[model samples]
Target chain A: MSRYVLRRVVESAVTLILATIVVFAGIRALPGDPARTLAGEESDPATLAAIRATYGLDEPLPVQYLRYVQKAATGDLGRSPRTGLPVAESIGHALPVTLQLAVFAIAIAVLMGIGTGVVAAVRRRRPAEWGANAIALLGLSVPNFWFGQMAILALAIAYPLLPASGFVSVFEDPVESFRHLLMPATVLGTGLAAIIMRQTRSAMLDALTADYVRTARAKGLSSAQVVLGHALRNSLIVVITVVGLQLGALISGAVVTEQLFVLPGFGKLTIDAVFTRDYPMIQGVVLVTATAYIVINLVVDLLYSVIDPRIRVGGPAL
Target chain B: MSLLEVQDLTVRFRTEEGPVLAVDEASFSVATREVVALVGESGCGKSVTALALTDLLPRNASVAGAIQLNGVRPSPRARGRDIAYIFQEPMTSLNPVLTVGRQIGEVLKRHQGASSRARIIELLELVGIPLPGRRIGEYPHQLSGGMRQRVMIAMAVACRPKLLVADEPTTALDVTVQAGILDVLRNLRDEIGTALLLITHDLGVVADIADRVVVMYAGRVIEQAGVHRLFAHPTHPYTRGLLDAVPTPGRPVLKEIPGRVPVMRATSDACTFADRCWRVTEQCRSVRPVLEPGPAGHPARCWHPLGGKE
Candidate 1:
């Protein structure tokens, strides 16, 4: 197990290095010049040159990349040209909001996904299963940005219950934070819920037909115990994988939903950095998002061993 | 009175090509403390008959006729408490995620409330699983195939069920392990006085453990008699064919049955085994043979019986 963990850590480090190289190269490959963007468009050539030299952009690409890697390793992402603040500080500010939204969305997705999946699989031929399947299809079909706007129109305009386009820190006021986050989190969760539900349903269908399920039934366990206790636990290995992948995706790719809801999250930060050619902020966001993706997958791998005793990492069967 | 009685039980499955009769008009009973073997070759409906006993067939399969226990029809609620089923593949029969103790304990808890941990260990010990205390915590894959089957048997007998239906229980085990599993099952029957309905394609296992043998071919019970009687003086040709097919030690040549068991059609007039039977006459081909009584009141389904003299 320790060997497994060590190997995974090494692999994650390699992935991070590769991701940094790609992000750094890709940002540089973008058409706009960061130095010219930082300086006024009408500024003299010498001023732009001075800005480029100061940021070390005038140096060769490899030297600049090495310097960027060195600075990033020490937790110093160069200052954002837009706000003149350290990119690390700005990312830190935006990360909590994105993490909170991701966490909430995933919680909602998992609960709804597993619950509906179990129900659908257990009462497979019944009307309830049909209804759950239809709901899942709708969840998968609707766009999150469109759903977010519809929620605002229905909840904020029609009902006047929530402020649809703002975020509040949960530490300051828990109730207000929940109220503000409920719509966007749910909107972001719907697609994830659908994906998770389909995977869970198919996995559960396979599990329900397993020989062990018949053994459980032959033991006089109720249908509830047979489905939930015997089958659902086995099905969760598949659902967890989907959750990890979809959760990471939501954390990094919720830019449009954030824009629709006006949440100042890392996704929003990423979009702003991209348009204004803020190299440091863009690289920092990509690095953090990629790291979160890797970490989430690693955590999921650990969870597989925990949930299934059959999965013994880095060892032959006992 | 018989502990479990199945009368005229027939199971049909509805598929895209319409219904297929898996088990047709099969009838048998297991008296108190009796080991009744339902023996047949593969695809002869032995396993389907066992599944029908516990009402565990899939949704597409429809079962007809009656299954009564202690003179009363057992409901689905009474299925596990009174009758339990062990499947062919023990590796897949035991839940991979649950500990051996938890799986056994669950049955006890459901049937007999508040099943303590001590009871789980006792059940494990009953099935000959070693180190009952430590082994109880291990998962299914941690154990060998024979050990996994022991866990399955432990779960089945946890409730002290009146009748245990084992569908080809030891077919997946190696030759050496098969004997030990059979011994454990025999011990279970002797100790608990639980009636055993052993389903198998192996005639050797039937001779070893079964008291009465019900020989099935093409989804019908073709012969039913005491195991010793049936082996000594086989009444039906199909039963004779089955007994002949078993390889004997030092035998010059093993006898082989002529053809495969044909799949049944919805409206068939011909005998199921006529195509495979050596004595396939014109009367046998055009008309189906019904199960009729033979000498000593043994039942054999054949138009021409192999009488003791023959």
Candidate 2:
């Protein structure tokens, strides 16, 4: 087990490093000059060159990359062009908002998806199963951004029940924060919930018909005990993998949802940085998100052994 | 009264083609403290009959006829408490995630509340599993095929069910392991006065453990008699064919039953085994023989049963 954990940690580090290089080089490839964007339209050539030298943009690509890596490794992500504050500090503030929203979205997805899946599997071919299937189909069909826009129009503008275009910190005011987060989180979670629902239903159907489930039935266990205790636990292995995948997607690609809701999240920050050529901020956000994704997957992998003893730590498995 | 009485129990599965009859008017009974072995080749409805006894067939399957346990028809809930079923593959029958002790305890707890841990340990030891203290804590995969089968036996007999239906219980084990499983089953029957419905295609096992044997061919009971009587004075052609197929040490070649068990599209009045019977006559082709007493006073469903005087 220790060996597996150590191997995973080293592999995660290598992955993060490779992701850092890609983000760094990829952001630099954008069709805009950071120095020119930093300077005003009327700025003289000397000021532009000085600004370029100040940010090390005048150096060779490798040299500039090394400087940025060294600064980033030390928790210095240079300065935000618009705010004139440390990029790390700016991102740190936005990070929590995105994390909060992602957590909410994931919670919704896991609960609704697993619940729907279990219902569908248990009452198979019944009206309840059909209803769940229909709901899952609808959720998957509608794109999340489109769903968010429609929700804002109907619930915010038309009904005026929600504030459609801003965010509030939960610490400052919990109810308002939840109110502000509800629409966007639903938009992001519905699509994920649909995917998870499908996976869970299929996994559960397989598990429910498994030989052990029959044995449980033969043991005089109630239907509830057999389904929940025997079938659900076995089905969770597949659903957990989907959960990890959806979480990574939620954290990394929540740009459209954040933009629609006008939430000050890392997704919005990283995207705005791209338009304004804020290379350091973009690299910082990508690195953090990638690290989070890698770590989440590692945790999921470790959880496999805990859930199933057949999959032992550093031992043979069927 | 017999511990279990199944009368005209027929099972049909609805398929894309149509409804197919899997078991046809199968009647069998197990008396108290008796082991009645249902012997047949694969796909001869042995497992289906056993599963039908508990109403455990899938949604596509429709079962007819009466199943009475302890002289009373049992509800779905009472079925499990009164009659227990063990499956063919021990490895797959056990929940891999749960420990052996928990799986057995679960059955005990559900049927009888709050199963004592010591009782669980006792059940394990009763099945001949050594080190019941440590072995109960282990999962199914950690145990050998023979040990897993023992655990399965332990779970089946947890409630001391009146009738235990074990379907091909030792088919997946080695010969040595097979003997051990049979010994455990025989001991359970002798000790608890539990009636057993043993399902296996292995006649050797039936001869070793079964007091009476029921032979099935193509979804119908062809012959049933005392184990010794059936082996010594077999009547039905199918039963004789089955007995002949068993390999003997001195025999250079084991006789094989010709053709396969027919897949019945429609349950006809004509004999189903006519296509594969060596003693089949025109009467056998045109009419389905009813199960009746022969010269040896054993029931066989053949028009011209072989004489019992062999």
Candidate 3:
């Protein structure tokens, strides 16, 4: 098991390096030059040269990349030209907000998704299942931005129950933080919740019909026990896989949601970095995002072994 | 009184195609510790009948008739407490995600509301799972087909259910592994006096473990007799066709009962096997023959039943 983890860590390292290269090349490929973007309009020629030299834009791409990697290894991510703040510090500030939102989103998605999915499957062909299905369809079909607006208008504008768009630190006040992030988190989580529901419902349907389920039923377990203990647990392996893959979507959704809510998160930081072409901030954010993906996938792999003993025998999918 | 009595049991599924009859007035009983085999071809309603015994059929199914244990209907509480089921696919019959111990423990827990680790180990040992201590920690996928079936048997017998309804327990196993599972089930019956309802298509399996055999054709109980008597006398034409289809040492080529079972329409209108029977008579087509004793005093639902000579 440790060997499997060690191997994954090595693989993650390789992927991170590849991601850095892609991010560097991708940013460089953009029409606007970092030197030009950093050196403002009406700047003299000497100023441009000085900016280029200072940022190592004058160096060969490989040399610059190696320098970037070296500094990055030593916990230096350079300063953003836009904010003139350390890239790492900017990300540090934004990371917590997005992390909290992500945690909230995941919690909401799993509870809503699995809960409804079990209900639909157990009450299959009934009115409850139909209602759940209709809700899932609507959730999947509706646009997030539009949903966000409607939610803000209804909850914030019409009723004035919540602050329309803002951010609050959970460490400061947990309940207030929940109230603040609830709208954006739900809007972001809606798509994932719908997806998990669809997957869980189908998986659960299959599980409910499985031979094991029959054995469970014949054991005289209540309908709830049979569905939850026997069927739902079996279906969770599929649900876990879906949650792992859909996390990328959640991250992307955060990009849109955080911006709409005007919360100072990695999403807003990323968008602003792209619009203004702040190369350091962009690289730092992408690197952290890539690292997060790699780590979460590794965690997902570990979770598979926990949920399914079969995976332990085969040592997972390499 | 019999340990189990299933009388006039009927099951139909409401599907998009239509209301399909899966089991039709199927009646049988298993006396205390008796091993009764319900044998038939695929789609002949054997599995459905077994599921109906425990109210285990799918939501689309509507079941009618009586399933009584010990002279009273087996209530919902009778499941796993008085009766337990082992399905055909041992590969799938045991939950893949759970340890063998946990699966078996669940039965004890459901009925008794408390289960000890020691009792679980004992059940595993009773089913002949090697290294019950270690096997308890392992999941279904880790075990071989035979071992998984043993685990299923252990779970079924955890509460010492009066009857263990095993639906084709050996069908998914290898030829070599099949005997071991059958032996485990037989041991279950012999050791605990647990009545066994063995559902299968294999006559060889019927010959192996069953004391009496009930033959089904197109959702109807076409024949029922002592296993040896049924195999020896082989009264009904369909029963003869089935027995004759089995190869003997002297036979040059194996005989096969041709034609698939009909997509039944109005079950009682005629003999369900008439279309597939070589000796099918006009009477066989015009009316349904209830199960009645033939000239040999052997019960078979047929217009013409063979005499006692094979």
Candidate 4:
């Protein structure tokens, strides 16, 4: 298992390198001159050139890439073109907000999804099943952005129940921060919850019909015990996979929701960077997001072995 | 008195097409200390009948008639520890994520509440599993197929039930492992005196283990008799067809019961085996023969049973 983990870590490092190259290349290819944008239209050619040189844009593409790699290795992400502050510091400031939203969204999704799915699967042909399925359909079909706007309008504009715009750090005021974070998290999480609920219901349905479940029943176990004890454990592997996939989307969605709520998170930062053509900020966010995605997947893979011993840690023993 | 008496048991699944009969008024019994083999091809409803005894049939399935276990009236909500079931695939029958000891321990805990860890280990050891003390902590995947099957048997017999219903326990095993599993079951029966209902398609397995044989054909019993008598003078055309299909050492290539078991499109008022039986006649197609004695203690369900003038 240790060897398997070591091998996976090596593979993950290679994947990370490839991802970095793709993001770096793709950002560089986009039609925009960060130096010109930073200098503004009124600036003279010499001032633009100085700005370009400062940002290492005057170097050849290969030389710039090599510098980016070297700096990235040393945790130096340069400075935001718009703010002239270090990009790493900006990211650090924004990351916690994104993390906070992602965690809350995921928690909500899992709790509601698994709960609804188990109930629907057990009830099976009942009206509750139909209702659960319908809710899942609604969740899958409705766009997150649309939902976010709706939530803001309903809770912020219509009812004035929640703070419509701006974010407060939980460390500053836990109660106020929760109140501000609640609506955005719910908006982002509901869609994922519906998906999880639907997937979990289907998985539970399949697991309930498995031969082992029948064996559990034949052992004189109560229906609840059979469903909860035997069926749920087997169905959890699929649920965990869905949860892992949604974590990336949740982090991405936090950006949109953060913007709607006026939260100074990675999403808003990235959007601002895109508008101002802040190459350093954009590149830094992309690298961090990509790394998070890869790391989460690795964690989930390790978890699979823990959840189900059947999954061999390493390749089959040759 | 019989340990289990399944009288006129019929199970029908409500499909979108119609109500498809899976088990057609199948009647059989198991006496204490007796192993009755419910022998049939796949889809012959042997497993359905076994499941119906414990009300373990699926929700779509509608089962009718009486299933009495040791004079106790059967109910859908009745505890099933009195009649345990061992399924065909052991790897699947035992929860893959759980330890073998815990799986067996669950049955004990459920039925016999507060059972000690030592007792669980003893049950594992009883099933001939090695390292019972240490192995109990290991998950199902750590165990081999034969070992898994033994764990299943251990789980089934944990409650010391009156009847153990083994549905093709050795069908998923290699020939050598198959004998070992059968031997374990036979020994368990001898030790515990728990009546066994062995369901399988293998005639050789039945011949080797069963004291009585109940042959099923397309959801109905075709022939039933003492193991020796049935083997000596196979009656129903379906039973003879099945026996002839079994490969014998130094004999000609075995004949198969050509074509699959008919998918019951409509209610089976006509003979279920008419399409496949070589000796099928107009009368065989017109009237579905009920199980009746062809000789003392031997029942055959056929219009013109073989080796009979009745």
DockQ of each: 0.69, 0.67, 0.69, 0.58
Candidate 3 segments whose C-alpha is farther than 4 A from its true place: A315-318, B308-310
Candidate 4 per-residue lDDT over residues A1-318, each given as its tens digit: 777678778888999999989988999889978877888878999999998888889999889988998999999998887897999999999998888877777888899899999999999999999998898888888888898889888998999999887777778999998888888888889888998998899999999999899999988898888998999988998999988998877877787788777888889888888888888888999999999999998888888877777675332321
User: TM-score rank, highest first?
Assistant: 3, 2, 1, 4
On the 0 to 100 scale, the lDDT of residue B190 in model 1 is 94
Q: Give the CAPRI rating of model 4.
A: medium
lDDT of 3 by residue, A216-238 (tens): 88889898888888899889989
Compose the digit string of candidate 1's lDDT tens values, residues A1-318: 677777777898898899889988998888988888888789999999899887788899999899899999999988887889999999999988888887888888888988888888878889989999999999999988788889999999999999978889888899998998888889999888888888989999999999899888878799889998999999999998888878766774478778889999988899899888888888899888888888888889888888887774332443
Model 3 chain A — which ten-residue stretch has the worst lDDT? A309-318
Candidate 2 C-alpha lDDT tens digits along B62-140: 9999999887887777655789988889988998888899999998888888788799899999999999999988888
Candidate 2 per-residue C-alpha lDDT over A98-128 given as tens digits, one digit per residue, 9 for 90 to 100 = 9889888988888899999999998998999
Candidate 3 colliding pairs: none
Task: For residues B90-184, write the lDDT of model 1, one tens digit per residue.
Answer: 98898888888889888888888878889889988999999999998888887889999988888888888889888998999998999998999
Better of 3 and 4 by lDDT: 3
Candidate 1: Cα lDDT at A97 = 88
- Residue pair clashes in candidate 4: none
What lDDT, from 0 to 1, does candidate 3 have?
A: 0.88
Best by TM-score: 3
List clash counts for every candidate, in order.
0, 0, 0, 0
lDDT by residue for model 4 (B37-116), tens: 99989999899888888788888989888888778776544445778888899877888788777888888888777777
* Fraction of the reference Cα-Cα interface contacts (below 8 Å) that each candidate reproduces: 0.83, 0.67, 0.87, 0.75
Ranking of all predicted structures according to DockQ, beginning with the best and ending with the worst = 1, 3, 2, 4
